[model samples]
Target: MLQQETRDMDGHYEFVTVSDEATIAFRRYGTPGKPRLLLIHSLALDGSIWTDVISGLQGQAEILCIDCRGHGWSSRAPLSYAIERYADDAAEVLDKVGWDQVVVAGCSMGGCIAQAFAVRYPKRVSAMILIDTTAWYGEKAPQEWRARAQKARAEGLASMAAFQATRWFGDRFRAENPRKIQEMMEIFVRNDLDAYEATCIMLGDADLRSALSGFHFPVSVIVGEEDYATPIESARQLAKAIPGASLTILPGARHLTPIECSDVIAEAIAKMIEAAAH
Candidate 1:
């Protein structure tokens, strides 16, 4: 049996074993029997990234926050860690929880997994919110990602902390919210190297540009104006490719828009949920 635990203060935490070698940790929040929303976090981070957004969305929807394999409290196993694999894992979680359909939202690498999920299981997703992510990495992405994987395997996650801080947050946010930035850095540093490397491989190899047209559901794309990792151009391409998709750009924000601009992201998701009701 899966080990399941719940707390009123911290929501519900459970570990579901997906395979002999892999177990995933996830949390559930909000009222049951409400509209469901699935929130996926970016690479090297966990479901906790959605803390602020969750607070803003309280009582409006039943939210599921998953700690992807090898991140957060989820198990780490030696596996391909392909984007498709991540999507499958997410589906497995839904199956375990008996959720048939949901409004899906993902940030950065999480966005890639969301695309893969929507492509593989179109009927399961009623709508999608893509945040600070791209459907396809450029041709050189594989090599760059491979190098990153190698570096992480050798140097561990600490070596990348400074680079990630600069890449994920704008200068102003870092300057203004030093404590929050430090908290995020701690999350990044805690990632297991093997899992981190596998995720990097997945990002390098996965391309969903051609798959975007298959989505007939409503889609929303959000990006930070100063996001260098997956810039506004990437979000624009997503909006253009996904028919009838809407785009929102947060001024002066960076890659981690969900954290930096939580209120906006929460408001956007609320609007999306409201629109889906009709």
Candidate 2:
């Protein structure tokens, strides 16, 4: 039997075995009968990153926040942590919860997995919101990611926290929200080294550019004006590729738009859910 624990009054933490060696941890929020929303977080970050977004969405929808394989309390099995694999794990979560369709929202690495999920399981995704992510990382990204992975394995995640923070938040936001920045940095530092390394490789290899044209669902691409990791240009390209996709760029935000601009993202997701329902 999978180990299950209820966290707080509004959220339930549960683990579902997705593979022989892997068990994925996820949190359930809001009422079950309401519209379902699956929230996926960025690389190295867990589902807790969506706390504010979940709060903003209270009483509006049933939210399932997944800690993707190799992150958070999810098991770090000896499996390839590819983006497609992450998508499959997410589908397993839906299957476990008996949800037929959901509004899938993901940020950064999670966005890549969301793209894979939409492409592979078109019938299961009602809508998709890609946040602070791109369809591809260019030709040189794989090499750079591999190197980073090697370094993380050697030096540990704590060494990368400060550097990653720079890409995750803009200078002004970091200065204004020092506590929040430190909280996120702590999350990064707590990551398992092997899982972090594997995820870096996953991000490096994932390229969904050619696959975007096939996504027929209502799509919304949101980016931060100051996102250095996945820039606004990448978001524009993704919006152009997906049919009828709308693009929104939040000013003064960085790679962590979902955290830095939770209200805006929550509102956008609410609109997407509303449009998908009709």
Candidate 1 at 55: error in angstroms? 0.3
- Model 1 per-residue lDDT tens digits across residues 48-114: 8898999888778888999998899888857658788789889999999999999999999999999
Positional deviation of residue 212's Cα in model 2 after best superposition, in angstroms = 0.8
Model 2 earns a TM-score of 0.94
lDDT digits (tens) for residues 1-278 of candidate 2: 95443225357789999865589999898765778999999998899888888888887888899999988889974667878889999999999989989999999998999999998899998999999998899899999999998888888878888899898988988889899989988988888877878888888988888988999889999999988899989999999999999999998899988888889999999999998898
The ten-residue window of minimal lDDT in model 2 covers 2-11
Clashes of 2: 0
Q: Tell me the lDDT of model 1 at 32.
A: 79
**Structural similarity to truth (TM-score) of each candidate:** 0.95, 0.94
- lDDT value, residue 144 of candidate 2: 95
Model 2 spans > 4 angstroms off: 1-10
Name the regions of candidate 1 deviating beyond 4 angstroms: 1-9, 19-21
